[model samples]
Target: MSNPAQPDHYSGLLQGIGQRLHSARQQAAQTVNTLLVQTYWHIGQHIVEFEQGGNEKADYGSGLLDRLSKDLTALHGKGFSRSNVFYMRKLYLSFQNSETLSHKLSWSHYFEILKADDPLEISFYTRQAALENWSVRELKRQMKSLLFHRLALSKDKQGVLQLASQGHELQQPEDLLKEPFVLEFLNIPQSHVLTETQLEQKLIDHLQQFILELGKGFAFIARQYRMSIGGKHFYADLLFYHRILKCFVVIDLKRGAIDHQDIGQMNLYLNYFAKEENVEGDNQPVGIILGAYKDHFLVEYATASITNNILLAKYLLYLPDKDVLRRQLEKLLLAEQWDEPLAESDSNE
Candidate 1:
């Protein structure tokens, strides 16, 4: 073989050079992206101005984009298509006088949202996407599934605005509970024979997407976390720490319907963590039982006796039909409203 020292020296030099080239490429990409965003912003501004006051003597402003697009494509390149020019105009109108426009949102993200017909909805998703630091793919998925509409249906108007504007706040116990947790990250089909072990492994493999699906502020703590009390040993499927809530979130995955015993078992896990394993400043451990199906009545009855912080929610392997979920949410809201009057009348006695 050749000299070992020579190989080591050459490898070190190659690594250094590779790192420098990577850094340079990243910087060049950032520079090019910034210039492109700025150019689009300026183009949008110019289009708006042209429409407002291009020439007072002649009606040249009406189809200026069409004529300009034709000439620019012929002379310059294909980037100045008529459709793209119209998007520029819409972009200016959409974000006029707003100071938040910046590199926080990429041009691709803006273009994706601009395809929406509703300006209000577009603005809402755009602001949310920027605040959440979502990729273009994530934005498209949210839009396709009508995440805003689902949240609006589930929460009150103020709550909806709060979630969209301030991001998810885990202040209250109820805030941690999402009716149907989105699991589009898991590529496994719903019909697949997926075991709990397989599901947990998949989640760990795609942990980043899992964290996103779990919402903000969640950091993975452990998987297959083991706990033993007395002669019995128990294991949690997944455990997370919510930074914002300052608590340990314990999740148990169940492939079938939830039972009363599952709630008790989860309570046991929570008690073990709270009394034994939790740090001095950590909040009481919260337990969530994610099952394929749950009987709402059984869940309420089982959880009612336990005073500890625990919740039972359903999980899906794929995105549920939005129309069906929306109707169900509406029905729940109507039932709550109908029950309120009866509850008030009963209390008055």
Candidate 2:
């Protein structure tokens, strides 16, 4: 026993015991969750096997799940609604191998993913959820935002397949780009007039969600990052250092379409960062001009001459129409068959 009057000894003992208790509680909760997930998977497997056994009496209709749900709730008290039992059946169908199921994801995560009809989309969400440890809420948000389609739109067929298989990989500067970056989380109405400053402030206010939308490897560095050139001052709208890319990413926000001057300014910022700000062993900085819209022809011609790793992208105030995006993605996938193979063969030649 320690004297209460001796604050140091008492505090140390209290903290040590508190930490141990917290850790133990976490371990216990994780064990219970893991067991629950495994048990649900087994139940799904059993249901599927029983259905396949040619039991016409049980296959009398969709009544099987309803009856099962009632019996389970009557016995176990909760957590087995008709919908939940249906998802369990889907869980067995979607991922037949119990060993392939992720222990990290809860049943809620699987439920959200199982709702997706596309196998590729399901696989992408599954891999991304497990890799990023996304909460059920986060998973729902991403699914609604059509994160897979957004990332896949820029990729060729092979790239799309890789995304479905490996999840988002931040290997280079281009890997970090997402066109029409969804900022619906900012909650600003598109009809409302917005200034560059107001948008920046709202982004800072929702910094956590903004960082999530920015994807992995981004670490916030500064806002309105100042730079000097020839006794004149310029401020970048947002500055981020990508931990994985090992470079600074300067973003300039535009309330409207990006102009030629915007391109020139971002190039200047990248040049300054590469020469003055970047320390040894740091890679060349990347610049992004994020605006409401841009003319593709104008951007292509403007950036074609400049050598800096500058990217131009749009930001939407509301969630994009997923159906429209899916159609566009389908077009890209279809075009890849005729385009990518030719390009690859040319490169080899």
Candidate 3:
């Protein structure tokens, strides 16, 4: 065989060249994206300015958008359609703070975030999209899945405002939980009977989407984490390490209605983790039970005395009813006495 040094040198050279080229291309792309977003901002600023002038041109300035779309499409050939122009105008209005804008995200990212009715939400999603480096498609998926509302189930109005300002920080036990995770991406039909093994396998197969749904900083550790207590053996369903929480997160899935047994089992798992698995510097582990039907009373009673961080939340195989869920989530947050000094859990995924 040839000298190993020759191959090693060539491999190193190849990697170095590849890295430099990739970085250069990324820089060029960022430059182009920054310019494009700035251009759209200017276009939107001009449109808003024109609209505010009260020119009395026509009903709702409808003709202005049509005329602009036609002329700009003729000039730019792409990205200046009537709908796009409207989005541009919205982007300007939604975030008047130039400080909130990022060169990392494209105009498309802003377009999707504008769908949020709340200004704080728009700001939150924009920051999160940039911070997460989420693609346009991923950003849209999170927004459509109602990630904000899911998190909102635990946070009050001030907490909601904090979420907008800081994004979801996984500090508290409540912060670790996101209610009613939407798993529509798994392609499991509502009619399809899914076993625990099948559900775990599906989540593994779609790990990327699963992690995104789990929110920030959750890194999958083991599928069925094993722990033996005395002569008996137990396996936690799915285990993850939350980098932000600096603690282990255990998930137990239930296909049917969850009762006291589910909570007890999860509590056992959490105790095992805190006692056996936890090393120095790590915080107490948290457990979550995602069942088809959640009995809040059962969960509250089961977890009342147990100090281990645990939550019982509902899960839907199919997409959730956004309006109904939004109202329900709002009610949950509003009902809570959230006046305590709130500390959102910090995480990065």
Candidate 4:
């Protein structure tokens, strides 16, 4: 005769204690992290104050940092090396106001955010990293991918500014798409030939990285989503659900330059998805045709008739040549006479 209720009571008590301990540890860690960040900010402020307005170098600035680093290392152990001290000073200059400091982020986050030279770019990364709960490594990955710069290129100056002030806004299809979508993480080379099937497989294999490249809120649905109409079967290359938009995204891959046929096929897929797959409370399906190259003029004409959110975009095997991409975007901006911002998905067919 054992007491079943007593065992249950003890188990519940243990669980409660464990939960309390875990919460306390988390709170303590956050407190320590916040204090450390503030300390580094103050250290940076002091170092900058020693330098002239934190920009012009004083005569003894180089040696001063070295001496301070050595002294700090002796007092506080290995974390205070010359580079670390330099970064602490940088952290101070980057976020000058105490009010701007974040308790949620550790100093490691600041170390990565400080790499951005542009102030607005820094702000955008900071906002996104916090909003997305991104680790330092994710922050580094995004910076290397030139996420902020690519997104900024697609917006007017005001929109770009808003991105810095507020994180990404996902009200429309264009809000979530990035043009000339970077697939460099797939490890495919420019010289390496990629077929549609092969590209689709690589994207699945590197699904996490691909989702990051695709922007946020995309959940993979099927690789070759099959739909039939009038006893004829057609396979979509890839299908995804965007959590934010609450709609399906169908992507068709092409190895060669884009043609009208590819766009027409994507539109057909969108129509099928809308009719068959959509349920109550779902938005209209959006289609994207991804190809190696697309003629801008042809894409413009092809997309003129469609009211639905069908878009065409170029896919890069390797990371884009940033210089060339910048030039092309600028050309697009000038061509439009700043009247309408070019939507990332509003290209190709």
Computed on alpha carbons, the lDDT of every model, listed in order, comes to 0.75, 0.86, 0.81, 0.80
- What TM-score, over all chains together, does every model reach? 0.74, 0.91, 0.89, 0.86
Q: What TM-score does candidate 2 get on C-alpha atoms? A: 0.91
Q: After superposition, which runs of candidate 2 have C-alpha atoms over 4 Å from their true positions? A: 1-5, 56-61, 338-349
Task: Highest TM-score: give the candidate number.
Answer: 2
Encode model 4's per-residue lDDT on 1-349: one tens digit a residue. 7766787789999999999999999999989989999999998888888776655442234787788888998998887877778778878777879778777788888888887767887888888888887888888888777777677666766677788888777888877656668888888867889778889999999989888888778899998989998899999988899998999999889989999888888888888888899999999998888888888778889888987788777777666566655555455556467666555553322
lDDT of 2 by residue, 1-349 (tens): 7555778878888999999999999888778777887888888888988878975223313889879989999999899988888888788778878888887888888889999988899889999999989999999999999999889876789999999988888888888777569999988887998999999999999999999998888899999888888999999999999988999999899999999899999999999999999998899999989999888778889999899999888889999998778777776776687673333332111
Clashes of 4: 0
Off by over 4 Å in 3: 1-7, 56-61, 329-349
Q: What lDDT does model 4 reach? A: 0.80
Candidate 3 per-residue lDDT over residues 39-89, each given as its tens digit: 888787888788789852322248888888899999879888777887788
- List residue ranges in candidate 1 displaced over 4 A: 1-35, 45-69, 117-121, 142-146, 149-154, 169-173, 325-349
TM-score for candidate 4, residues paired by index: 0.86
lDDT at 256 for candidate 4?
92
Q: How does candidate 2 score on lDDT?
A: 0.86
* Model 1, span 134-226: residue lDDT tens: 989988987776665555544654575566555554686667777677777788877797788888888899998878777778889899899
Candidate number with the higher lDDT (1 or 3):
3
> Candidate 1, 236: how far from true, in Å?
1.1
RMSD of 4: 4.0
